[model samples]
Target: MLYITGTPIGNLDDMSYRAVSTLAAVDEILCEDTRTTRKLTNHFEITTPLRSYHDFNKETATEEIIEELKAGKSFALVTDAGMPVISDPGFELVSRLQDESLDYTVIPAASAFTMALVASGIPSYEFTYFGFLPKSNQKRQEKLTEILHHRKTAVIYESPHRMKQLLKDLVKFDPKRLVSISREITKKFEQHERKTANELLHMMDKEIPLKGEFVVIIEGYEEETVNFTGTAKDHVSELVNEGMRPKDAIKLVSELRGMKKQHVYDEFHK
Candidate 1:
């Protein structure tokens, strides 16, 4: 039985008893970094042997792990932090395991995504979890564009260095979009801010330490009100004039204005 164990994003006390037991009991533990896993193993006093399994050697690792699984070995998979197979190397192994009909379940623990969600105070009843934006500028722009059309709240992970650049691009595209920046979750300096991308940039200048890992929660693209401040509103009004009802026009206008439907309708017609 393979176990996908979630480790603390921070704060060792966040580790669950089940996670410790799973780490202790597994025949072999796979990790992205042996040194980091050693810290966790040492902390928990888990004696399971460790094997390195990172993205570069994922394919080779999967082959070895599969061989072990086939031989009736029970192993635990963990990453440096958070859950494995989630924006991490354990995905290939999990896919291979599924293909080979290997039995596995999660020993879930703390995740930065959920920590950010809770800190942001956003509704999680309906949300889209986007692990990370593309690293390339073009692909990242494409992803942001796709997300701009999404209506549900989105949870996204990002590196500290690129986060500032990401906010810049986000503001360039749409400055009014609500975004939440969470950093150093579950740690002494843990902080979360609910603001627009532009606001986040300014906030970072004033408040954010900008030194830790980050998870960015973006409010999904909602149609704006007619009170919008830019050319985007003109595009929506143009759509309304093209045989579209005021209601539909308001919907389009709201896509950029972040205003009420009636206000958009009134402004569209007025």
Candidate 2:
């Protein structure tokens, strides 16, 4: 059996009894960081031997670990924080396990993305998780463009140092886009701020301590409604000047361009 157990993101108390038992019962534990896992095991008095299996060694180490499992030695997999295979390792193992008909199950624990989303006060009914944006300016801007248009909330992980730069980029594109910045997941200083991109950037400059990992949840675009009273003519003329019929212009502008038709009509009339 291959147990994919989750470790605490920050608060040690988040470790569940099942998680402790699974690690203790397994013949060996494959971890991203042996030292980090060692401390967790020591706290719970789990005696399972540790083996390093991380991003660098995942391809080769996974095969060796699988052979051990097939040999009747149960094993547990864990990362430094949260769940494995979630912006982390275990994808390769999961795919291979499914192909070979292996036994595996997940023991879930605290997740930074979900926690940050929930804490954000952002609508959680539907959301897209983009683990992290590309470091390049071109790729990052491309991602930001889609993220701005995306309807549901977007969750992304960013490093401490890059967070400020990321926020600056966001503000440059859309100052009014709301966002939630969360850090230190379950620790004493665990904090989250809900505000627009500009607001969040200012808050970070003022409040955040400049350390710890960050999870950013950005709100989707929602255009504000404008009263169609008299602006309809001007709006219509504006679209028509841009080469569109009064009706199609209003419809197109309102439906796609985010300008109300009545407002367009009022504008044209004027």
Candidate 3:
């Protein structure tokens, strides 16, 4: 049996009893970083042997680990922090495990994005978790555009260094949109600042510190009430007639009416 466990994101006290005992019982522990997991194991007095299993060695490690599992070795998979397979190295292994008919289960624990969202006070009834944005400018802009047009609250993870750039992009796309910036979650310097995109942009260096991991919660798009008397296609055509590009017009109509861009595009083009 493979146990996919959750480790504390920050404060060590958040480690659950089951997680500790399971780690202690496992024959071997597969970790992204042995040095980091070492601290946790040492604190709990768990002597389970740890083997490196990260993105670099994932392909080869998966095959070896699967054979060990076939030989009845019970191993526990863990990331440096939080749950495994969540923007971490476990999805491929899990998929391979399923293919091999191997049994595995997850041990639930805190997630930074979920914690940030709850602390954000944003509308959480509906949400979309976008683990991390693309690094390239063009790809990132396309992703930001998708988020801007989405009707559901969006959650994203970002590195400390890129936080400022992300805020600037948000401000450029939609300054008035409300956003919650959470940093160092569950840590000593943890903070959650709620403000408009533009406000946060201006306060980036002045108020918000550029340190630790960040979870950005963007409020869902609110439909704008426009006094337009026409069908959806007609609305798209009307915007295009007013000097807007066809694609831009479609995007605008979709956001304003809370409809999918493809639906609007199809109607307009037909």
Candidate 4:
């Protein structure tokens, strides 16, 4: 059995008693960084042995861990912060464990994304977690476009250095769009700011300092009803005239009217 543990994101007090005990009791503690995990173990006096299990060595480490589990060894998997396997290593291990009929369970705790969502004041009925955007400009822009069109709230993880660029891109895509930025979660200087992309961009350095990891919550796109009293081709044509690509327009029309994409494509191009 493997214990998928959740560690404190910032505050050490957030570490649960169960997590500490499990870490101490486990045959081995698998962590992304032994040094980082050592601090936590030292704090709680958890003397269980620590092993390196991160992205670089996950493929090889996973198989070895599987064999140990088969031999009746129980391990606890943790990351530098937050829950293991969430935008972190351990996913492959968990998936492999499932495949091999090995047992595992999660020890829930604080999550920056969910905390940011509730604090954002945006409608949380439905939302999407887009962990981190691509580092490049073109790919990031394409992803930003997709997020801009998403009808539900979107959550994103970003670094301090790229915070400005993210806000800039958001302003370019939709200046008036509501966005919430949360940083230093569970720490002394934790801050949550809610404003439009343009407003936030203007106040970047002055008010919102670039520091700590950031969780960006963007308000969902509210699509307007398209009342086109015309043929399917005409509907597609009108969208195309408004600068939407023909292929994209066809897809939008199909989605709005609940028709198949190929059916709409045939009508529009016939």
Which candidate achieves the best lDDT against the true structure?
3
Candidate 3 clashes between residue pairs 3 or more apart in a chain or in different chains: none
Ranking by TM-score: 4, 3, 2, 1
lDDT of 3 by residue, 1-270 (tens): 999999999999999999999999999999999999999999999999999999999999999999999999999999999989889999999999999999999998898999999999899999999999988766676677667667799999999899888887777657888999999999999999999988888888678888889999999876551256788999877655544567877888887878999999889888
Q: Between the candidate structures 1 and 4, which one is better when assessed by TM-score?
A: 4
What are the runs in model 2 whose C-alpha is more than 4 Å off?
Answer: 223-270
Model 4: per-residue Cα lDDT over 1-270, one tens digit each? 899999999999999999988998999999999999999999999999999999899999999999999999999999999888878998889889989999999998888899989999988999999999988766676577667667789999999999998898788667889999999999999999999999999988789889999999999876552247788899888766544567877887787678999999999989
Prediction 4 global C-alpha lDDT: 0.88
Q: What's the residue-level lDDT of 14 in candidate 4? A: 97
* TM-score of every candidate relative to the true structure: 0.80, 0.81, 0.85, 0.88
Please give the TM-score that candidate 4 achieves against the real structure: 0.88
- The 10 consecutive residues of candidate 1 with the worst lDDT sum are 224-233
Residue 33 deviation, candidate 3, in Å? 1.0
The RMSD of every model to the true structure, in order and in angstroms, is 7.1, 7.7, 4.1, 3.4
lDDT of model 1 at residue 264?
Answer: 64
Model 2 lDDT, full chain set? 0.81
TM-score of model 2 vs. true structure:
0.81
